[model samples]
Structure formats: C-alpha cells, structure tokens
Target: MSRAAGLSRRQFLALGWFPWLRPRHIGLAGARFRILRNGRSLRRYLRIHGNEETARQVLERHMETHEGIAFVIESRTRVVAVESLQLDPNRMFSRVGAEANLKLLNPGVAPERVRRALDLLDRGREKLVRALTPPRGGMTIALHNNSSAYSVTAEVPISDQTSLREPGNPHAFFLCTDPRDFETLKTSPYNVVLQQHGPKQDDGSLSRLAAARAFRYVNLEVAAGQTERQREMLNWLEWFLP
Candidate 1:
C-alpha cells in the first residue's frame, strides 16, 4: 500500500463487526478532568470526551491495572458546561478550536460572555495540558470510542500512512503522531495510522498538540461497545510502544 503498512484492501465499509466495549472532577469554571494514577511512568493516558462511554470504561479498567496516569473528564455527556456555556473538552486545548466550538455551541451567547469564556478556558487549558503532556521519551496515549458513522475512512484522507489489519473491524484502529512509533505499531497485527505532520488548522485535539510539541501521541479509537477489542488493542500498544 504505497509507503504504508501492508494492509489488504477492504471495501472501506462502515465499521460493523467490532467487539463492543471513569472519573469525577466537579467544576464549571473550565474543562475539568479527574486524575487516575496507577503507579508512575512516563506514559500518560487520556479520555477527554465524557459521552464516549466505551472509552471511559476502557480507561477506567486499564488504569486500575496499568502503569500510567489517566485523565478523564467528569461529565457523562459529550458537551461539558463551563461558565454556563457548552464546550467540548477535547476542543478546549487550543484558542482557535476552543473559540470556534464555543461560538458554535452557544450561538446565542453574548459577545462579552464569549470573550470571558475563552479567557477562562485559556487559563484552565494551560494547567491541564501541562499535566497531560508526556515527558520526553514517554508516550501520551488516548482512548476514544466511535460509532459506525465515524470509521477509519473518515481519517484515511488526512493520514500519513495506514495499516488496516482487521478485515471485519474497520473501527478498531490506532492513530499515532510520531513516525518512529508508527513504524513499531505498523508491525503489529492490528490496524494503525501514522499522522506525524500537524494539520494547517489546529482542531485543539490532543494529537495536534502532540505533533506540534514533537512528542509521541497515540490514540486507540475503538467501536463504541467493544471493550474486549479495545483493551486488546490498548494492551498491544502499551507492550510495543514502550
């Protein structure tokens, strides 16, 4: 498959056959996430989207036994209420993305309120990013759960390289932000995509921050409900990424 990992061509069908598959930080000032530290390691884990129940479950279980710090948002829904405004935690990492999301989510919000909200987010973003960012030589791994509507096909266009291993499970895949990490991950028996280059427009996603900062970032996006498969993929990533 060009310079990509050797993956057989599939119909790129909407992910259908995948095995199906944590924290309380109470705050409204800005995006809040509770910390789950299981031993100490350079490796860091994340579950930013609160509505992604599958990811939350996987991260909660993984942290109980894994050696890394896990950060999970406190909410049970996708959009979090901050300053009486709905904001996507994942999009609060950068100013541009945060501003766009803030406006889109709260269209009726006053102009002054929007400015104040962004300021609050900016302050909170700094602290969270500091704790979330992995150290040099460490890995920042994120767990995300997606439905059939969101498949690897959505990412194929922007991905630098891909390895589609599971013939029936198109939703189970790994996305990494470093080339060297991709090289190691591609050798695995699962699907993986290498996206080392940062996009021109930042989405305020963790992967974008990782690419900009030149750190190793890996995201395990599994079909919503496939905990077994997600865990397996996560374990595989930990085993080889380290």
Candidate 2:
C-alpha cells in the first residue's frame, strides 16, 4: 500500500494483461502517475514539480470532495520521465517545448538519442494531452507553488491582461488563459493575469496549448505551503467560473 515505488515497469505491464486493472489505475508514461476520474468535467494536475507540496495538498484535498479528474504525479521532484534527464513535466505538452526540455535536461546529449526520445515522447504526449484536456467546456486547473524569487513582475512582460493588487504578494497569483475568465478573476481579491494571446516565445507549457485550443485553463499559483490561501482561491473559482 506504500505509494513509493509501487510497481516496476515490468510489473505494471504484467498487471495490465488482467482485465481488472483498468486504465485509470494503470500508470502512463513509464508509470509516472495515475488518473482519478470522478464523474465531473473538471480536470486537475498536481506535483508536476516535485517540490510544490502546497499546490499538491490543495489539489488533493479539493479532488477528494469534488467530482473531477486529477492526475497526481508520483514523484517528489520536478523531473518525472527519465529522472536523469532532468526534464520538467509541465514542458512536455508541445513539440517545441519537448525538444527544448530534452536539450535542456540533457546538455551535450547525442543528437541520435534526442531524436529517439522525441519520437517516443511525441506518441506519449498525444495521449497525455488528451487525458489532461477536460470534457467540452470544462476547465483544466493546474496548481503551482512559487518561492520568493518568482513573482508577478516576471510574468507581466508576457501577460496580455493583468490585475495586480497594490502591494499584493507577488508570489501568490493566478495565470489564466481566457479573456472572460480574466475579467471575472480581476474582480476577485487575488492577483490574476490573462495570457489568452500568445507571447512572442512559447516555452511549451500546458497553458500555451490550452490557449491555442480555446480551452478554459486556470493556474492557481501561490507561495509554497499556503494551503489555506490556495484552497480559498480554488473555492472562489468554482463559484465564480461556474
């Protein structure tokens, strides 16, 4: 019952042969995570970066009582696939991002190996992206935690719409990808930004892809361990966005 190293790739593949082992329970992308679907259109992701425990706690608690699907990465670090590669899971959504991630993670990597990895990820990325996207009109919410250094100012340069509260804690804010959502969130007490329009450069994060598809994506970012604050914003979103 321990969550740590629950099953090896070989064991997982062996178990998949049994009819009882459903896809929801089975891991994806080398057994990185399991998707829990609760008869709701809402989709959520946590622990994309292993150290974001505050985000993980908030989402986990929210999922327990709400009807939705949540993908919980089973790693304590940012790098999920090929740990040695040091790639960020959030950057695996787009082709350009994936290429950059592989290169960044594996500096001086052989071109042949990089190409091979991209070929493999391209296939897996399609499945993961589909799984991440919610049912029609549903929202994909990703929770993240930031340290002191990361703040709203850094995002302001690329933000198409922004509502920064005077003296508001920059470490805690929201990054949304829909204009209407931004309009609504701007009225709220927290800081919010709209990136509905793509910035000149694309880092290949989920937000960019979601924006491209016109999906309603909300990212709740807060200082690490600010569970109460994060939960409040999440609850506010359910009422405001719905």
Candidate 3:
C-alpha cells in the first residue's frame, strides 16, 4: 500500500469501529473521514468532486447553483480528477471548532467591523501610555504585568476593560499581551485554546478545545522586540485565518 493508503488505514483503526465510519454514509465511495463527536471518532465521508478542478467547478457551481452557500476552499494537495461529491456543510463547520464559537459571540456582525475595532484599539496604544502617566486615581496601563516606565498627562484613564470583555459581543475585539494570556482568558461554555510562543500544537488547537471543551481561546502572541520572535509570531498567525 502507498503511504497515503497506510495512513488512511491507521486513521480508520484509530476511529475504533463506529457506525458513522462507513464511507457510503458520508457521501464518499472509498475515502473515509472521521471526527470526534462526544469523545468518540465518528466516521463520515466527504463528497469531494474528484480532482481539484472538478472540486473547484463543483464548489463554484454549488454557490452559484444554490443561494447563500458561502465557502472558502483551500487545498494543500493538488486536485487532479473528480473523485467524489458529498460535501457536508455541518462537517465543515465542525472542523472550524472554537473559531466558530468566537464568530458566534456576535451574530450578524461583518468581518470588517471586527477588523476596524481591532484597529481602533491598536491606535489607543499611544493614548494608553499617555493615560497611564503618573498614577492618577489608580488608573494605569501595565505591560504583561509591569507598570509602564513613561508617564503622560491625559485626562482619560486607561483600563484593561477597553480591550477585553466578558459576554463579549461577536463583533467586539478581545486583546491579550501574549497567547498564554489569551489561553488563560477562556472560560466555561466555550471551547478555544490560545497558546503562547511555541510550535503549533499537533492536534489543531480548536479540536483539542472541542474535545476537552471550554470557551473559545484566541491565541495572540505579543510581538517581542527581537526580529526573529516577531517573524515567528507573524508566521504562526498567517497559518491561522482571522
């Protein structure tokens, strides 16, 4: 068997015999896809349109053919021939896991709105420093956990609440000094994990959160001054779609 086939077999065994494991059920003839549902890998087949071109055409047709079936297609492997055609929307959503939850926090909010909010908060950095100057009424802006050395005279007090919130609307932006801070902010009723500067976790952060299950965690690595650290941080976020 080829390496890909061997890997598939191993994945099948890992799924540990469940009714959903059958390929026909998921809409594929031979290819099998399984996801952990309630702690067990539930098997399902993805209806793929053979090769890349066909898949693209089918997906394009699907959107044009049907109204409101928005999707983004990413292929790490080249598509050749039309192989299958059983794409399940629910499966795709499940694949997104925690990021989906974050999106849900604010229903009906456009992506651009959230982007603007983040931009606003980032601009507030200068204001934050000015506001932190000379501890008036105990209002201050601290870094990670330390006080800012510089001080400025600004009437507006800087508070952490500006960038973070509980019961945050999906449209609101959340900020953290580091990925570790972000991971720690997650709470019950949502499942997301944010990790600090490190190699990408093997299991995909969303899958881990979904299985273990906690509020969504948005990992944001604070940019360090070192060029290499900043590069690594950007590279990591690049792999992740906002």
Best by lDDT: 1
Arranged by TM-score with the best first, the candidates are: 2, 1, 3
Higher-scoring candidate on lDDT, 1 or 3: 1
lDDT of 3 by residue, 129-173 (tens): 231122222211111100133111110132122222322322112
lDDT of each model, Cα atoms only? 0.80, 0.77, 0.27
TM-score comparison, 1 vs 2, better candidate:
2
C-alpha RMSD in Å of predicted model 3 compared with the true structure = 21.2
TM-score: model 3 vs. ground truth: 0.17
In model 3, the Cα lDDT at residue 197 comes to 29
Model 3: runs farther than 4 Å from truth? 1-216, 221-230, 234-242
lDDT of residue 223 for candidate 1: 86
Q: 2 or 3: which has the higher lDDT?
A: 2
On residues 1-242, what C-alpha lDDT tens digit does candidate 1 reach at each position?
34223433452222212312022343335556777766668988888888889899889988888887778877788888777888888887788887888899998889888888888887767667888889878988999999879877777778889888775777888889999988998898888888888458888777888888888899999888899989998888878777
| Candidate 1 least-lDDT 10 residues | 12-21
The runs of at least 3 residues in candidate 1 whose Cα sits more than 4 Å from the true structure, single-residue gaps closed, are: 1-30
> How well does each candidate superpose onto the true structure, as a TM-score?
0.84, 0.85, 0.17
